[model samples]
Target: MPDMRVVLARELGYCSGIRRAIDAAETALRSEGTVAATDTLLHNAGEMNRLGSIGLRSVELLSDEELGAATVLLPAHGSTLSEHLGRIASARAVWDLTCPIVNRAHDAVSRFADAGVPIVVVGDKEHRETRYLMEAAGSQLLRVVTSEQDLDTLEISVSRVGVVYQTTQSREFRQLVLAWFRRRGIEVAEEMTLCPEVLRRQDGAVALARRCTAMLVLGDSSSANTRRLVAVAVSACPRTYLIGDAAVLPEVGLNCVDIVGVVSGTSCPQTTIDEVVAGLRQVCPDVRVEVDAWPESVL
Candidate 1:
């Protein structure tokens, strides 16, 4: 087998918002007797398991039975005011961990709706963040499109529109939608709503993919950012694979390739990244791993 080289994406692992959410969850677990999260607080099952050991529980919805906890924590993805108003009204102590970027998205959607501009939300329809954005639109003329193809189904006969996307969506997808609208002679308000850190990670994935024969992204399947990373990597390298953690490394057959790229989403913990790197070293002992320098602040 040829000597192997592993190129690490520059922007991998947790971003500032995810770091804050994790810290807040850990803090809640320490002080509260029981804490229930609106959703799996940030998508990393290992981290959730660790928090669960300390009395953190995640509920799909905030019904009466789920609201008996001492504290209810909101996921960093944020939720719609209309959809979550009842829960917010009933919670005894609520720790809203919604990221500021997502809050801005809600504001942007509200503003566009208020202006009577047709709003298009570009993201996965099932994603929590996208669902919240849709709910925020209220009775406004709104459409949700995961790709450019979805736009064709929209009966938008208007000349002007506004665009907002799930915080973790790629800029490439957003631009594709914008370009499509512009081609049809429609004026786009263009609220460039994607998260900067998420875009940075996607760019990092593309850069690494260009030089590697294979790429492995570490993150949970449920995470929007994780799915974006896989999509970005697959565009540049067909051998890209998305794994939840280091344990899946050998099974993914990284040993069969000579050059590999490694990346993770903002929801991924640094410990997971370390384990993935170690797993790569162990499985391919002769390989040279060149990890890019990342800021220590996120760790």
Candidate 2:
């Protein structure tokens, strides 16, 4: 008889902001006949597909044709609110679903740009959230970096640097970047704009990894927070795998590990977590699963 134990992270699955965005999108789609988003409204493909089946359209960028034909839903990840709204200009019904925390991040970066301070963003340069932050900063002196190596390539001439990161970046990574800039004698304004829930998820991932023999992170490939969860888990538990769903569990050699921790990205659906746990049960029928509640203390 194989002895298998699975533990669920306390802070796994969808955060309030994502829930609100989805709820709002669903409500709007029902009333508006057709709704379009500036980008994928949520990173979870399952949730996106659900909305798609009901006629929720995703547009890479809004053009006159899109603005005129349907209600445009701005994503929870920050978008150029004023700019986008202005472009529409009373031509269409618009729902501003930008998360309040993300809006705050945008405002913080705008303030730094207004003060003429050189800006450095710690996140994936091509990420939608990072792109929003860059757009909010306008033409200010800006550099975006993910690691210490990326920082070395910056050609910044300013002595004073303003720092802000994507809402999904882990706090530990943010501190490391801040320390690196300070060591170089740069005056770094540390305006950490990370989502509290997302940061908590990373904390939870670290704790989950420390206790489990292996870890499974649930999230879509395009989810930033999901990728962060994977990174955090791998740092502590070398046997960490990022899977979009539970179907990959078998191929990833899960049966070899006696204990596994299950953590998910903020945007990941609760149903996916349930499905993964169910799949685990099916794989190891006699396995005992426990809910790891260590993350509750941090909350």
Candidate 3:
């Protein structure tokens, strides 16, 4: 019998921004006495659990008081200016791990809003990223929605519109949004704010799954990028499953399959992927584990 050939997408795992965020968090945890993160380090549960093992804790950006010798780390997702102002008033020092791309999108909100463009952000309203964008735009009201109907439901009276997306949103979603405006006879002036990491990861996942009989994704269920990876692979490869860890790998007639592709999301730690690979190797000892030859990066 041929052992399964296992593969991984080129652009799987943590991106550069997440790497920086985790690094800053670990540094804060190791610092003497006490340090505070304006909020959770990242959205990944695995990463958050790892941080919890250390001395760090998640503090609301709204939580402010006198801090004697503590370092306050602004969220990598970037808090609103108002939140930063509140934190700046008392923290000894601040470390900002905000991703450069995310920063640009934030800056655009105000720039476009001031130019009389109605701002419509495509992301979850409750998310910290979207919240910060709303704050930066300084609008008494803003609209946040996910689907086409959500866009049509908006009562925005402006003729011109400024559009931006959640950091990890799919390009297809954005395209659909763009097309919607065209059909409605409204023009959108969008910022160049697509998430490079998500685009890269989606491309990689699609490419890698094209050849594999089955695909497996490792990530937290709540992670948008993680779920997006799964969706990307599944669209190309019919057999795809998103697993939180290695122990969840389905062994249903594994002896019948010739190959499987494995991948992880930006929020996933490399260590978790290694563990999954190791576990699967134990299950299918002869499985050929490989990575793409094209290219893969931290994104």
Candidate 4:
């Protein structure tokens, strides 16, 4: 018998933020009877497809056709909240699925701006969460990249910089950016509010990958956390695959690997993980499967 060992990452799966967002969307879909949103509730294609089969659909932004009726769900990735306020004013109902973790970040910046601190949101400019935070904070926001190029070009002299981050970005990235601003001797009141769910899941992915030669990172392609997990696995182990489901598995191999690991993002469901694991086991019956400790530490 080929000695096969499968390392199952304990932390590989949906984060609490995605769970809460999906639950809120489902509940809103049931209660409101019809719903639409600015974009997909989560980055996962599988979950969006599942939602499509039910009733949660997205509409073109602020069109007259989608106006006057129906509930709209703002994705957990917070966008400019004020942009929503006016549009939602016309809707019969609004189901705010903004993750509490994100909402806490929003509050931090909003309160800081209200207190007259000049705010600098450190993250990708195009991300939905950054956009939302800017809108919520109104006039007190400017986006900052890793270097000072963007900040140097700015015409304003900010007395105090209030920093906020995207909930799903790497915690290491968040810390680096925060430290960069403070190093300049500028007054900074920074809120380190990146979602714990992200760091927890990321650490879990790293831990799980340690025991396996190969890993399958289960998650949507666009999911920040899922991508991070796949990256972590590749770094820890030699070979890693990022797949939405078992169908995404490469046809050429899997039975060849003596040790394989499976992990997923916070947005992924248990069924998807089980299905992939089952398929891998079917291909290699002798493979030993064990839980990776990352998720256990998180819980």
Please provide, for model 1 over 1-299, each residue's C-alpha lDDT reduced to its tens digit, 9 standing for 90 to 100. Answer: 65578878777778988889989988888884667887777888888888888888765444675575458888888765753676555666888888899989989998988887788888889888888788777777468898766876766877888888888888788778878887899888878788888888887788778878888888888787898889888989999998888888778776635688898988888888889878887887677778755432220
lDDT of 4 by residue, 125-198 (tens): 67687777777667877654533465556543555677877667676666666566676666778788777767
Ranking by lDDT: 2, 1, 3, 4
In terms of lDDT, the poorest run of 10 residues in model 4 is 290-299
In candidate 4, stretches whose alpha carbon ends up further than 4 angstroms from where it belongs are 61-69, 146-160, 294-299
Clash number for every model?
0, 0, 0, 7
User: Candidate 2, TM-score vs. the true structure?
Assistant: 0.91
Candidate 1 structure, TM-score to reference: 0.90
Per-prediction TM-score:
0.90, 0.91, 0.89, 0.84
Stretches off by above 4 angstroms in model 1 are: 1-3, 59-69, 293-299
How well does model 3 score by local distance difference test? 0.76
Give Cα distance to truth, residue 206, candidate 3, Å.
1.8
lDDT of 3 by residue, 76-123 (tens): 777777766774657777788888778888888878778767788887
- Better candidate by lDDT, 1 or 3: 1
lDDT, candidate 2, 102-124, per-residue tens: 88888899999998877887888
Decide which is better by TM-score, 1 or 3. Answer: 1
